[model samples]
Target: MIIFGTSSSTIHPAKLDGGCCPFCKTKNQMWIQGYRKYFHVFWIPFFPLWKKIYSVCSHCKGVFEKKEFKDQELTTSFEYFENNKIKIPWYHFTGIILVLLLIMLISILPFLTK
Candidate 1:
């Protein structure tokens, strides 16, 4: 049986003072974070897929998504973090590495047989 699945983890975390939380109306309490999803085989991440941007209000425990960011300051901070901080980790390519090793072995087997 082949074990394959998807998983997500927090890749970035930062405090945003750009806008007040819509729910709590509190400034400097919103946290910007990034979550990355990856495909995995047997619990080992194989490759990365989509990234999700989220903000949470610590004062009221409210959550927001990328589309919900309305304030210009909030949006700017989010874009900067996404563009500069978020990156696919190296471990996510385990599947590709395994496949390449398998291919190499197969190629070498033919030479060894002769």
Candidate 2:
């Protein structure tokens, strides 16, 4: 995410002291994994809109919007493995190809039928 404008600062869980929860202030704090700030853009039929926002405290297994709390902090994490890998199923590609073929067929059906 892009952090624009002034007063934009990123804080991490490690940097935070043993303080109360920014949300509940109940001292139930957890580690923050990653954080980012950006504008969430939405396209409307006649207008384009955007909301400047921040995402924080994702590592605690809880998602919170920046507006939900005060004194927002940013965090990040990195994990590496020797044999880590990600796989994409063949059926997923096949499904996409099938959808494209169907759309093409529909678009040309009128011409073919004539």
Candidate 3:
């Protein structure tokens, strides 16, 4: 999920422009690690999984948590069409085809041996 706001000096700006904080405006990149909580017993063994968030800033040197960064709206106004355009690359399709062919060959080989 993404959030966007603009910087303003008034009590409340309808939108946020871009707040300037020492760390928010820094020019550095770092990884922020967070934890994922499991609420059910189905995931008892891996109760907590570490999640890594990649981030880059222009002003701060240390890593910032997800809450620290202000969200920005993507201003792209393009209409998306729902045509049957292949999103995956050709190599990915080839890889999947190869895996399926190998599995089929393996199954047939066992039948032939009997």
Candidate 4:
């Protein structure tokens, strides 16, 4: 069976200063991260979907969704990270190449057999 799933990569850490982490109560110790959804077959990520944002408490290691951060500073930080974030090419539509190659092989198979 083909495995379908999503994956995550560290787009950015807590490089810039920010507010405190609610869970750990540590000032300026929150990290902004993201999870990029992808489709996988045979455990290989093929196609990517939308990405989601999260806040990680550096001290307590508590994870919070984007909506969970109600603080103004934290909200602004999140928006800043998102705006400056860069998109990697390999993280997108990885399965399209495989699909196209398969199609080409299938179309040529009958001709080869004849």
- RMSD list, candidates in order: 2.6, 13.2, 15.8, 4.2
Candidate that scores best on lDDT:
1
Any runs in candidate 3 off by more than 4 Å, and if so which?
A: 1-51, 71-103, 111-114
Worst 10 residues of 2 by lDDT: 77-86
Off by over 4 Å in 1: 102-114
Across 49-101, the per-residue lDDT of candidate 2 in tens digits comes to 23223333323444454344444332221111101221222332443456678
lDDT of each: 0.82, 0.36, 0.32, 0.72
Error of 4 at 88 (Å): 4.8
Top candidate, metric TM-score: 1
> How does residue 76 of candidate 1 score in lDDT?
78
Lowest-sum lDDT 10-residue window in model 3: 74-83
* TM-score, model 2 to reference: 0.23
- Identify the runs in model 4 with alpha carbons over 4 angstroms from their true place: 1-16, 86-89, 100-114
* Steric clash pairs (candidate 2): 11-74
Weakest 10 consecutive residues, lDDT, candidate 1? Answer: 16-25
**Which is the better candidate, 1 or 4, if ranked by TM-score?**
1
- Per-residue lDDT of 1-114 in model 3, one digit per residue for the tens? 433222111111022123333365532233222222222222222122232332333346444444555533201100011112112223323434566788999989988999
Write out the backbone clash pairs for model 4: 46-95
Question: Considering lDDT, which of the candidate structures 3 and 4 is the better prediction for this target?
Answer: 4
The whole-model C-alpha lDDT of candidate 1 against the native structure comes to: 0.82
How do all models score by TM-score? 0.78, 0.23, 0.28, 0.62
lDDT score, candidate 3, position 77: 8
Clashes of 2: 1
